[model samples]
Target chain A: MKKDRHFYWRLFSSTFTLSAFTFGGGYVIVPLMQKRFVKELKWIEEDEMLDLVAIGQSAPGPIAINTSILVGYRMAGIPGALLTVTGTVLPPLIVITIISYFYIAFRDNHLVKALFKGMQAGVAAVIVDVVIEMAARIIRNRRLLAIIVMALSFIAAVLLKINIVIILLFCGILGAYTTLRSKHDARSSPDSGKDESCAEGSGTGGSAGKKEGSD
Target chain B: MIYLQLFWSFFLVGLFSFGGGYASLPLIQEQVLKINSWLTPAEFMDILTISQMTPGPIAINASTFVGTKVAGLPGAVIATAGCVTPSCIIVLTLAVLYYRFKGLDMVQGIIKGLRPAVVALIASAGYSILLTVLFDSDDYTFRLSDLDFIAAGLFAVSLFLLRKFKLNPIYAMLAAGIVGMVIYGFLPSF
Candidate 1:
């Protein structure tokens, strides 16, 4: 019983400290979590960590939170999941709350305004880089369907100004349909070469490309 | 009532915010700026900036910040909870199924389909932010004379550094802010 309590404490603190210190968001925190749990603690295997990250990415919502839930659950079940989530969230909740209180004061400062103006430009550039890299990956995969969906979605968003949720729903349904159809086709034509009807399941899509060429 | 609205808005953001941090920008924009006028365009940009600069996920930071702005500490708590609730539930369910089946072809297919669309959403969001920074307006219409060349130059240079040097985005943002302070704050550019 005592050992179990100590383990829970360690789990919470590790996640809490990681969440508190990591500044680059989900992409940054995820690897750190792997190092701590897989490398440092030796609690989870390297392959298992990779699988957790894949599951985390595939699920909706922030990758950090999703990852935390999975890791915590794997380690200790529902209580551990609850504890790790609270630990993961508390840092940002506290930090942002403090900042929000002083935000009005900061907002009116001339120097602060100029600084934010500069950051806005940088933020824009980063976003553009993300779009380009992500789009490039899809294009490089040589999947016609993926490329067409990407182009159409971009046009829909920029020109037509369609609601984003609707676009996501349409693409998801289309993806599932293509996969199901392709599977069916492959079953009937047993001698057929690898089916290319569905986009390759490069589960590391969009934001997951962060560490691609950086090394 | 306002608290409830904030929860629901962020809940939708959590639900549909696929891909990752930047992809959530449009969903949050839809909620905070379009459906509800809780924040003006400038305020929205500032919140995003703060979110990017801080730790944790941008989605959580933005939700907490917006919640506080709209209501108070309670609002922040509620908004943060709403943002994370979907993640916990969905991930837990997925974890269970994953251990059982070991193969999630259907989920994989859906994610494959969502990938390009998520990229498009991020692009659209970036375009809007670019418009606001360069043209000082979010609308489609802007005069050439109204363009901010300095910000555009910063954007180009930042993009080059990020792509070529693989500079950390936090450092890039900080450098840009320092340059902003030098030119806009101290220099006689006004």
Candidate 2:
């Protein structure tokens, strides 16, 4: 009992510290969680970590949140899961609370105003990095089909202002058709759609690795 | 009314927020800014800025900040909880059916389709941010033009430094913050 308790505490602390400082939400948390969970604590193996990334991405919610819950739950079951989520969320809750207060006060301050101007630019760059990185990943590694679908969706949402929900549903059907068409193609082996990335803005997680492992 | 708003904003965002955190923004903007008028367009824009700068999902951050804004301390807790609760329930349900539908072709296709859709959603939100926060088209007033160019350059240079140099994002953000502070001291943002 004591051993388990200590284990849970360590996980809580480690995950808490990690989540606290992780700026940029889901994608940023990837390597950080990899270091702690895969390398330092030896909690999850590398391949499993990748699999978890895929799983967590597909599951729902932010990748970090889902990952925390899975790691926490695996470590100590329900209690462990609760502890992990708490650990991960607590620091942000505290820090953001304070930041929220000061941000409210400082929103109009010249210093903050200047700071956000730069920060906003940084945020855009991060998004650009994500899009570029994914484009390279898919273009070099995946299919031309993925690019076409992405462009179509962009037109649908940006040009149309069609509620994202409707676009998602409509495009979702089209996406499935592509998946089905590719599935039985003789040249394509199994696992072609297994390594998707949710954190990097793709909602699914199986395509990249699945394709790669076939070779 | 404020308390009611806290519940409503969260409930609505939580109800519709699918795929991931950024996916929540459009729904949130509609509820908090357009539908209810709880926050002005400027204040709503500020909330987004703060959300990006801080930790956690943007959805969670908005819930906490807006909740706090509308109703104070209790509002923060309640709103955050509300935002997360739906996901918890849904994910738990998802966990049960996870294996049964694991290899379904349709699911894979939906996911594939979602990528483009998700990208579009993000692009749209980014556009909305630009419209609300960056430019004033009617008068053509450059609200923060000087800082805008500097920030864009900073972001581009930092990305180069980050990928080319293999430096960490923390270092980049900190360096940018320091740069902002330096610019604060030197140039008059007035």
Candidate 3:
């Protein structure tokens, strides 16, 4: 699908505004993204937002940038992705640079120190909220296999202190193996209405090949 | 030379920081604190607080902050670019191909499997920060005096406001900062 004449500008400006106001982190920016992309622009559906976030979370680097790239690519391909990522990253770079110039001057100030101490607590609390919100969503699926994978991953990540890349790699392989076996079994039976794989939401561009194996 | 170091340091941070910003903290600490000696542990905590108040991903905010301190505006630019380059490359490629292969059951399954792990990683990240802020040492030891009651109280109040009232965290952070000034900045005699 062809994009509008000012697609790049729209992509850049939208992401720029969103990133400029996004405090906390990825979860905080997501709802704003839904409003802008799903509601206002009609770029993608609500469920598709979740998929984009999931893809972002699974990928390396910050979820905010990853989501921008995904949404941008969906709207206008690679250039769109590049533009959005640049826009999303710009606010932090500019603001933090300004802050750093004064960091030394203020580092030893009593008021500043106290304020940061308090903010540390606040930041930690917000992180707790993020953890709870994410956990609740993941658990809602109620798939035993999924839960098991999560638990093992937790052990590997938090307990054993294994590298995150290793955990993700293993889980990716396991997911692929488990789902491939299930798909083989389902092929012999009558097709069901619920096709998890086909649940990916559509957008104006990058339709990819439609799922063709199952009727 | 320092610019290259800044670029390489943040580049690794961006590459390995999977899940989200918070989950990337340990990696950031390793690079900034352990390897580079750019910031001390206490200074790192301060910057982390600043990161939250600032508008951006924690990892990006951190890279910019450290980059500026280490070098200057150019350092900030290079570090920020380093931090984002991995995402740009990886996500752009994935976005191009994902929808094409998204129909495969395995792709869906992998996402499903990764969901819980992401939660776990996030939780662990949060828990570690919570411990550091609330307690004196991060040794997993429980001690009364070791606990910073003021910080702990602020954490409790902030968590309550965020989860129960669904308050925007920015306000809570601002409020807590004010309270911190009152308690730590002014009430030293008490």
At residue A194, what lDDT does model 1 achieve? 50
TM-score of each: 0.91, 0.73, 0.81
lDDT of residue A33 for candidate 3? 89
lDDT of 2 at B60: 75
Query: Which tens-of-lDDT digit does each residue in B32-106 have in candidate 2?
Result: 765677776666666666666678877777777777777787888777776665555654444334422434345
DockQ of each: 0.58, 0.37, 0.61
What's the DockQ of model 2?
0.37
Question: Candidate 3 lDDT, tens digit per residue, B1-190?
Answer: 9999999999988986766767677678768865788986567877788887789999999989888888988998899999988988877666556666554345467765666776776666566677778884443345677788899999899999999999987888888888977898876742
For model 1, how does the per-residue alpha-carbon lDDT over A1-215 read when each residue is reduced to its tens digit? 23367889999999999999988587889999999998998777676678889999999998888899988887777888999999999999999999988987778788888888989898888888888888899999999989999999989988898999999999999989988997788788964445332223233331132232112
Off by over 4 Å in 2: A1-4, A34-49, A135-145, A177-215, B1-31, B34-53, B97-107, B131-189
- The digit string of per-residue lDDT tens for model 3 on A94-181 reads 8888788787888788788888888888877887887888777777978787777777877775678786667766776777787788
CAPRI grade of model 1? medium
lDDT of 1: 0.85
Q: Against the true structure, what is model 1's DockQ? A: 0.58
For candidate 3, what's the TM-score of chain A, rounded to 2 decimals?
Answer: 0.70
> Candidate 1, which segments miss by more than 4 Å at Cα?
A1-3, A191-215, B187-190
Q: Candidate 2, TM-score vs. the true structure?
A: 0.73
Quote model 2's TM-score for chain B: 0.71
Interface RMSD of 1: 4.3
lDDT of each: 0.85, 0.63, 0.77
